[model samples]
Target chain A: MLELQDISVIFHPGTIHEKVALSHINFRIEEGDFITIIGSNGAGKSTLFQTISGAIAPYQGHIFLHQQDITSLKEHKRSRFIGRLFQDPLKGTAPSMTIAENLALAGCQGHYFSLKPILAKQRQQMYEALKELNLGLEERMDTKVGVLSGGQRQALSLLMATYAKPQLLLLDEHTAALDPQTASKVLELTDKIVKKNQMTTLMITHNMQDALTYGQKIMIMKEGQIIDVINSERKKDLTVEQLIHLYSSKTNDYNDRILL
Target chain B: MLNQVVVIGALELGSIFAIMSLGLYISYKVLNLPDLTVDGSFTLGCAVSAVMTLSGHPVIGLILAFISGLLAGVVTGVLTTKLKIASLLAGILTMTGLYSVNLKIMNDSPHISLFDCSTVFTPLSVFGEYGVLLFIGVVVIVVTLCLHYFLKTQFGLALRACGDNEDMVKASSIDVDIMKMIGLSLANGLVSLSGAIYAQHQAFSDSQSGTGMMVIGLASIIIGMAFIKKDQMAYQLLAVIVGSIIYRGILTIALQIGIPSTDLKLLSAILVVVALILTKVKMRRKEVC
Candidate 1:
C-alpha cells in the first residue's frame, strides 16, 4: 500500500513563469489495488507518478509505502520496491544491451551485485519469460534490444518491470506509442500479469475504453486534482459514455478528443 | 638494422600505451564519458611512480600511482555527479587542478629521471631490450583479462547499463552516480598504471609526458574498433589493445619516413579526425542498409 498526503509540485516557484504542476493532492492505494488513472494533458498524472517513483521531490508532502516514510528516498533506492514502465519503450530498457542482460539487471532488485557470472539459470528464466510473450525473443536472447520492434521492446520492458515482483508497479502510458492491435495485446498482457501477481499497480492511460475496461478502481483528474474516483462496485457497471458525461459535467471544459 | 630497431621500439611503447588505451576505452566507450582527466592522471602516475622508484620503492610507487589516479577520478566523478557540472568541464577542472598536484609530488621539479633506479624491469635485465617488452606485455595481458572478466560480472553489467541507459539503470535500483564514480576510478587507475610503467621503461617522467594522451588513446580505440568485431565485450577490449599497437606502428613508420618528431602531436590529432570521420561514415552506411 502507498499513500501521498498534501502533495504539491511547483515548477519555477515564485517567478513569473511559475506554474503549479500538482497541488495538495492526497491519494491512498490499498494492497493489490489496480488503479487506472485517466486525465488529459497537464492533469498532473505524470507528475504524480514521478513523485511516487521519487524522480521528483514534492515541494510539500509526505509519501508513505507500507507505513514507512519514503518522501526523501532517492529515485534509485525507491526503485527496489517500485517497478516503472515509461511511455517510450526505449526509456524502459537499455537499447544497447541484450534482452538477457536487461532481465538480469531487473532480477537484481534488493540484491548486491557481485563478481559472479549472471548464471545460466537466470538466462533460462529470462528465456522462459520472453517465450510467454510469444514474440520469439527467446531465440534472440543475445540480440541487442535496439533492433527489436516497438511492440516487442515494450513487451520485454513489461517483463523486465514485473520480473522482480516489486511491491508497486507504475505504468505511465506504457502502451500509448504502440499501434491499436499491439496496444491491446500489451494491455492484455498487463492485465494477465497484474492478476497473476496480484500486484498493486497504478497505470495512467488516455484511452477511455482502456480506463473503463481494466482495473478495480478508476480515477479521473483535471488541473492537478483528482476530480473523482469510482470504486470497483461502481466501476464494474460504469460506461465510457457515462464517464465522459460525468467528466464534462464536472470540468465544464469538455475535450471530446480525449475519449479516443 | 635501423628499421628493425624502430619496429621493436614501436612495439615496446605500443604495448605500454595499450594499457592507457584500455583505460580510455572504459571511460569513453564503456561509460560513455569523455574524461579529460586522463591527460593529467597519466602524468600523475608517472610522477608518483618516478618519485617513489627513485626512493627505492618501485612496487609502492606503482600502487601509489594507481591510488592517486583513482583519487583524481573520484574528484572528476564527484564534480560531474554531485556538483552536476558537465562531465567534460568536470574533467577539465580536475585535469587543471592535477597540474599543480603533479608538480608538488615531484618536489617542484618538472621532471624526474629513474635512469639509475631499480625498477620492475630490473629483474628481467638479463633479457636485455626484451625486458621492457616482456614486462609491458604481461601487464597488458593481465589488465585485459581482468577487465574482460570484470565486464561479464553482474556489477560490470550494471556499469554498462549505466552508460547505455542511465534511466533503466536507476529504474533497476542501481545508483547511477556510484556506478559512474566506480567506473571513472577504475579507468583512471589503469591509465595511471600505464604512466607508471612508461616512466620506468623510458627512464624518465616529465610533467608534459601526458600531453595529448587522451587523443592518442581515442585514436587507438577508434582504430582498434574499426578492425575488430565489436559485438562481444571481450573482443572490444582486445580491439583497443591492438589499436594502440597499430597506432604506434603508424607513428613509427611516419618517423622512419623522415617526419619530424615535433609533428607527432599533429599526427595524433589527424589520426583522431580520420578515425572519427570513418566511424561516422560507417554508421551512415549502416543506416542506409
Candidate 2:
C-alpha cells in the first residue's frame, strides 16, 4: 500500500562533511506485509523508515500511500496513518502519566482539537486491551508508566502504536535494549498483535535469528541500498547460517551484532 | 500575632495572587515552560482593567484583561515556537515591549487611580466588611474547579504529555506547537485576570506593579508544591493557593518587623533562591535514600 521511488537522504549536502544516508532507494510495501529489515550500521534502514514516516524529508523522490502522494505532509499529520515505535521505551510513553492515560492518548489519535474527557467506554476498552497483554497491567491502570519494567513499557508501546489501528506501523529496534527473555516476550506480543490486527509492519533488528524467524520477508541492506529481499517462499527454508552467508557474500563484511 | 482584620486583608490579597499562581501553575508546572510573559501579561491586565473600569464597565474590563493576556501569551508562543526564540528570551522580549504597550493602554500615564470608580466588589457592600473577601474567595474556588476540570480532559492529557515528552505526543498524532501555544494563552489569560482583580482590590493600577511578579509567583508555587507530596492535581492546586497566602503572611510579618518596603523585592528574589535550593537538596536526599 506504500511505495517509495528513487528516495535519497543526504546530510549536510555540498559540505566537506557531507554523507549520504540513503541513495536512490526504491521499495513497495504491500498491504498487510510484515517486513523485517536487517542492516549493518549506516545501512540507511532507519533513515528509510524516517523518510517514509515523515520525520526527515528525503532529499529526492516521491512517497505514495494507497497511490496518493503524501511527500509533503508534516510529520504530525502523517502520524495519523503511520504509527512509529523507537528503540528507547521511554520515547514511546510519558513516564509521569498513568497507563490508562497513555492508552487514552493513543486511542484519541487524529482528533487534534478534541476537548472530550476519557469516556467510560474508552476506559473499558483500555482495560480490556491491557488485560489481553497478560501483563497484569489492567488492575494497575492508575500506576504510572515510569515504574514499569522495560518489557512492559515496550509491550504497552506496541499496543498504543497499534491501538488506533494506523495504516502502517514502524518498529525500530523496539526490543533490542531489553533482556533476551523480555525481548523474546515482547517480540511474541508484537507478533500476536500484528497477526490479530493484520497490520503492515516494518521492524528493524540486528538479530540474525529474529530476522530469519519472523515476518514474511527479510530485507537485507548494505551501505545505503536495499541489496536483497527474501520473499516468504525463500524465507521458509532459510537458516541463520545461510542468511549470514548470503549477507557476507554481498558485502564481504561480517558484523558481530547481526550474527547474534 | 496578627489581628483578624490584618489576616482577612492578607487573605483577600492572597486570593487575588492565587489566581495568578494558578496561571503560573499551568505554564511552569504542567507545560514545563518558564513563561516570563507573566510579568508583562499581569501589567497588561491592570492597564486594560483600569481603562475599562474608568469607562464604567468593570465586568467588561476583567474580560478584556483576560483576552489581552491571552494575546500576550500568543506573542511569546509564536516567538518561541515559530520564530525559534528561546522561551526565556521570548518572554523577556514580550515583557520589555509590553512596558510601552501598558503605557499606551493607560493613556500615556504610568498609573491610574480607581478610588472613586465602581468595581465588581462595589455592588456587594451590603455584605458588610468581608464583602470583597467573600467575593474573591468564591471566584478563586470557581476558577480552581474549572482549571482542575480542564486539566482532566483529553486535550489536557495531550498538553501534559507534550510537556512530559514531546516526541511521544508527536507520535500520538498531536501537534506539539499548537498545544504549547494554546497552553501559554490559557496561562497568561489567568494571570491577566488576576491583575485585573488586583487593580480593583487596591483601588489603583500602576505600570510598575508587575515588577518582580514572576518571581513572586514562582516562590508561591515552589513553596506550595514542597508541602504537597501527592501527584494529584487537586492537592497541587490547593498548595498553590495556600502557598500564596503563606507568602503574603510572611510579607506581613516582615513589614511588622519594620523591614523597609524598598527591600521587599530583594526579599522576594532571596526567597525564591532559598526555596529552589531547599527543593534541590530535598530531591538529592530522596535519591540517596
Candidate 3:
C-alpha cells in the first residue's frame, strides 16, 4: 500500500504571493487498486500527482511505499518504484527514438543505457508487446517516434510505462491529447495493460465519464484536500450526477474554496 | 583533380571534426541547447594534450584532454542546471570562464606547442606513408562506433530522454541535472579530444584555433543530420563523420578554386542558413503530406 500523511505544499511560501497548492493531503492507495482522481482547475489534482511521483516534494508530510518511508528519496530513486504517463503524449517518450528503441529503452527501464546492446530475445519480446497494440506498430518498430500521430504516441507511451512494471502507475490525463477514437483506443489499451499487470494505479481524468468507468476507487478534490473517496463497493451504485452532487455538497459547505 | 593525398587529408580532417560534431550533436540535438563553451573546451583539450605530450606522456595527454573537456562541459551544465541560468548564456559564461582556465592550465599562457613530442599519432610514422591518416582514421572509427553502441544502451536512453524531455526523464527516476552534466561533459570531451589530436597533428596549440569551432561543429552536425535518415542512430553517426569530410572537402575545393580565405566565415554561415531552411522545409512537408 502507498500512503500520504498530512501532505502539504505551498508555492512561493512565506512570500506575499504564497499560494497553498495542497494542504494536509491525506490519502491511501492499496496494491492492485486502481483509483481515479477528479478535480476542476487548480483543485490540486496535478500537484497531488506531482508530489506523489516525487517531482515536487511536500513541505510537510511523509510518503510511504509498502510501509517504507519514501519522502526523502530522490526523483529517480522514486522512479524505480513508480511509473508515470503525462498528459502530453510527446512528454513521456523520446521523439527522436524509433519505436523499437523506445521499447528497448523501456525494457531496460532507462538503466544500463551506456552498455549492452538490445538482445535478440528482448527485441522479440518488445515486438510481441507492440504487436498487441494492434496499430501495426510492430511493423514500424524501426520508425522514429516523432513521426507518429498523437494516438499512436500515447499508445507507445502506455507501452513504455507498463514495460517496466513498477509498483504504482501514475496516469496524468494521459489520453487528453488524442482524438475521441484514438483516446478510446488508448483507454482500451490502458485498461487491458493495467489489468494484465494487475498494477496499482492512480489515474486523474477531467472527463467525468472516464473517472466513473475506470479505477476501483474514485476521489474528488477541491482545495488540496480530498473531499470524498469512493471504493469499488460504493462506486458501483454511483453515477456521474451523484459523483458531482457529492463533490459539490462537500465543496460548497467548506465556504472558503471558490471551486473552479 | 582529387589527388589521393588530398582525399586522404580530407578524410582525416573529417574524422577529427566528426568527433567534434558528435559531441556537439549531444549538446545541441539531445540537450537542445546552444553551447558556446565547446570552443574554449576544444582548446582546453588541445592545450592539455600538448602539454602532456611535451612532458613525454601521449596516452596521458589524450586521456587528460578528454577529462579536461568533460570537466569543462560539466561546468557548463552546472551553470545551466544548478544555477538556473539560461542555456545559451550559461554556455557563454562557461566559455568565457574557460578562457582563463585554459590559460592557467597551460601556465598563464593561452597557447602551447607540442613541437617535438610523441602524441598518440606522432609515433605512428612506422606504418610508412599513409601512417598518420590511417592510424587516426582507425581510432576515430573505433571510438565513434563504441559511442554509437553505448548510446543504444539503457544509460544512453536515459541520457537521450534527459535531452528530449527533462521532466519526463526526471519522472522516470533519472536526475535531470546529472544527465545534463554527463551530456555536456561527454560532448565537449569528444570535441576536445579531436582538438588534442588536431594539435598534435599540426604541432601547435593556439587559443585562436578554437575560434568558430562551435560553429564548425554545428555546421558539420547540420550537414550530417540533413542527409542522415532521422531515427537511424548508427547511420546518423556515420553521416556525421561523412558530413565532416564533405564540409572539409568543400573548404578544400573552395581554396583550390582560389576563393579568398577571408570569405570562409561568410560561406559557413550561408551553408548553415541553407541547411536550417531545408530542415524546416522538410518538416513542413511532413505536416502537409
**Candidate that would win on TM-score:** 2
Higher-DockQ candidate of 2 and 3: 2
Candidate 3 C-alpha lDDT tens digits along B1-289: 7788878787787778888988988888877878998888888888888788888988888888998898899998899989999889998888888888778777877667776667777567798668988877887888888888778777787777777766667667677888888889899899889888888887878876787888888888888778776556778787778788888988878877888988987888788888889999999999999
TM-score ranking of the models: 2, 1, 3
TM-score of each: 0.98, 0.99, 0.90
Pull out the clashing pairs in model 1.
none
Error of 1 at A114 (Å): 1.6
lDDT (10s digit) by residue, model 2, range A173-235: 999989999999899998998999999999999888888788999998888899999999999
Regions of model 1 farther than 4 Å from truth: none
Model 1 over residues A94-205: C-alpha lDDT tens digits?
A: 8888888888888887554688768998888888888888878899999999999999999999999999999999999999999999999999999999999999999999
TM-score of the second chain, each candidate in turn, equals 0.97, 0.98, 0.93
Q: So what's the TM-score on candidate 2?
A: 0.99
Instruction: Give the C-alpha lDDT of model 3.
Output: 0.83
User: Each candidate's lDDT (Cα)?
Assistant: 0.90, 0.91, 0.83
Off by over 4 Å in 2: none
